[model samples]
Target: MNDNDVVRDLTLDGNAVAGLLEEVFGADMTTADGECAHCGSANAVGALRAYTRAPGVVLRCPACGGVIARIVQTPRGTLVDLRGAAHLAMRR
Candidate 1:
């Protein structure tokens, strides 16, 4: 298997997390603009590839496959790690 195959097998479009994002962000954020910190790739939050088989949701840049964000739900609360994202512009 190749990188593309692996990626395909492990990921889904960011839309899969629409409800989770709305819950975390307090609004529909699927159409939000996002910039990847790792590769400088820009795309809609909904356009990013999402890997949900982990303990949390891992969103990645589709162009470069760099992680853009990670959202985890813990008993304490939700943990949003955006270290992989340079910017996220959500519409009002």
Candidate 2:
């Protein structure tokens, strides 16, 4: 997708977007290594591991721990938010 497309569709806050990406891409359970596009970090063991929990799924820089934006796929096409079963928390 182009930058304009991303700006229009995934305009939500960064953290929310991160969570959404994680859910959509199965980041939490991912076992593959991914490079952080921002800081060029190569520490993403899984999809979720590439992000930081503090900022609510903010993509972390593997080399410098910087935050980066991530894109995820969905039934409605590519999305920037975590709106799947994985992102949902169980209620007590």
Candidate 3:
């Protein structure tokens, strides 16, 4: 196998991380609205495609398949990368 051949074994819906998201964000983020920075497609967080087979969790846009977010856990703390998301709107 080559390093380029990333084996993504499983694909799940964002809803699968409901408990994790609530633990991290302290709210139900699955219902949040997010805009993809790459494709500019707006979608609910629950609708984003989720891949958890890697070291971290990856959320991808359903429209363009652009990465929307990455959540990784480290010794010190958890790392959240949202560069792929233009903005995430949480309901009050």
Off by over 4 Å in 3: 1-9
Candidate 1: tens digits of C-alpha lDDT, residues 1-92: 99989868987988999999999989988999999998887899999999999899999999998888899998999999999999999887
List ranges where model 1 is wrong by over 4 Å: 1-7
- Give the worst 10-residue stretch by lDDT in candidate 1: 5-14
Listed in order, each prediction's TM-score against the native is: 0.89, 0.34, 0.87
Clash pairs of candidate 3?
none
1-92: candidate 2 lDDT, tens digit per residue: 89978543533333334445456655542333455554444543333324333333444433454444445444667645422222322222
Two-way lDDT contest, 1 vs 3, winner: 1
Q: Residue-wise lDDT of candidate 3 within 5-58, one digit each (tens)?
A: 444336787999888788889999999999999999999999998988878899
Question: Candidate 2 versus the native: TM-score?
Answer: 0.34
Compared with the true structure, model 1 gives a TM-score of 0.89
Estimate candidate 3's alpha-carbon lDDT, on a 0 to 1 scale. Answer: 0.90
Error of 1 at 7 (Å): 4.2
Candidate 2 wrongly placed segments (more than 4 Å): 1-22, 26-29, 46-56, 70-92
